[model samples]
Target: MIALEKQLKDELKRFEAKEESIETIFIGGGTPSTVDPILYQKIFKLLKPYIKTNAEITTEANPNSATKAWLQGMYDLGVNRVSFGVQSFDQDKLKALNRAHSPKQAKIAVLTAKEIGFKNLSLDLIYNYQGDTKALLKSDIEQAFELPINHISAYELTIESGTKFASTPKVRQEDDELAFFVAKEITKHGFKHYEISNFGSYESEHNKGYWKLKDYIGVGAGAVGFLKDTRYYPSTDIDAYIKNPLKIKEESLTTDELLTERLFLGLRSNIGVDKNILNKAMKKRADFLVEKEKLFKDNNLYKNTNYFISDELVLYILG
Candidate 1:
């Protein structure tokens, strides 16, 4: 908490100097609900000035730790949105993923947050893991609809470096067939598949900003921030960050690199990229995809018809 305060104070100074007005605040990647709500009170007070009038203040929480008191306390402190990390509602799937919370606990947490006046609620659901059957996926989707959440992030399980799953390697089941099925099922429930992994009636403005290449200040250890053509990375070491939060490594992107990012990120989400950004060759490919009914044109922007094949589409367009 003390370290976080120091970091926030430093970031606040930058905001003031740049006259930056923040539209969204997402407290995620770590279990924020585990921290006492009182810890955020001082931080919110300090940030109240720069926050926009209708800013979405979100906190990512675990189903087990986000109690009613915690939800109410944060809501009172200006947290209008809560994204719970409820990976699965099935007991076997929960155990396979090693989630601490049970199925019942996930239900209780969402209901609790909604009852406490959280207007915008979201939950994460992992699909396409090994042993994840169509029946199991359907059940998870149905259970999610029963909850009061307005958004759902249905992610495919990937075995990243140094994780326990990496050792087993058998836990991951990623394929185009399964991905399309899972995505179609979620959209059938009326949640727009806004992003490749995210589906929601209430899209995350913070996430949308990233796709649009908006600048944001990322705090804490191992956090990355983007500002125009440059990206900043603070020390990943927690102790080093607490000692000096200002020590950051910077990377400058070239015009080509930025263009590549704009294309890839834009196609992966509903945020379509401008036609003016593409060259003669890329524009031809975009037109081809449009003719094939794989891409849609909205005014001057080109968007992917299905997000499941976004990577392949990006490669073909940029090839």
Candidate 2:
């Protein structure tokens, strides 16, 4: 935490805060609750002036570790949002997924955060894993809505290389119908389907900003930072990063590469791709999809009606 704080102190300077206040700060991907909240205090204190007053401060937590005291400690630090990694409510499924927390613990963690005055609460629910059925997912969603959470991220299971599941990739069931079923089930509860995998009454600015290609600081090992068309990779080696935090590898994207990226990210979320950003050939292809009802045009923006085919749509447009 100390090394991270020192690195962040320098990294955050890259953003010209005079032009715009930081809108969102996301502490995610890892188990944030494992560390003491007291460790985060200095970082928050440092960020106060550069961040907007209404900035959505979110921290991702594991339900098994986020106790009431931990939740309270984070709440006291101006952390207004908690996104628990509660993959499912089904005990059998939880065990199958190798989750640490039980359904009871997940519920308790969320309630504890709410009790600590967290207004924006979210949890992740995974689908399309082997043995997932409509009934099982329905029960999971029902259990989730019973909590005081305002948001849910429903992610499809994908077999990334090098994980245990990678050897048996079939564990990630390729069921398109189940994907549609999950979306319908979640949105029927009155939440907006803002992204391919996210549904919520209160949308996450941190998430939207990423899709819109906004610049964000990335301080931790292997974390990525974006500024305009270039990406910065801090040393993934933790010891090297702490020893010399200034050393970073940079990659600058070409116009085509940047456009390709924008299309993929935009089409996967509520942020539609701007027609002006597309070249003449790309614009014509997008217009053709719009006419074919595969995509819908809202004024100057071309949006994918079905997010499942976002990759195909982008590839076609790029061609």
List candidate 1 stretches off by more than 4 Å: 13-20
List the pairs of residues colliding in candidate 1. none
> Candidate 2 on 85-199: residue-level lDDT in tens?
9999999989988899999999999988888899899999999989999999999999999999999999998777878888888788888999899999999999999999999
Model 1 alpha-carbon miss at residue 64, Å: 0.7
In candidate 2, the residue pairs with backbone N, CA or C atoms under 3 Å apart (3 or more residues apart, or in different chains) clash, namely none
How high is the CA lDDT of each candidate model? 0.88, 0.90
lDDT of 1 by residue, 1-319 (tens): 6777787777666545232288989887678888899988887877777888888889999999999999988999999999999998999889889889999999999999999989899999998789888888999999999999899999888888877888998898766687788888999999899999999988999889999998887888888887778898888898999898888888999999999999889999999889999999999998999999999999999988787778898889897
Q: Estimate each model's TM-score.
A: 0.96, 0.96
Please give the lDDT score at residue 34 for candidate 1.
Answer: 86
State the weakest 10-residue window (summed lDDT) of model 2.
11-20
lDDT of 1 at 9: 76
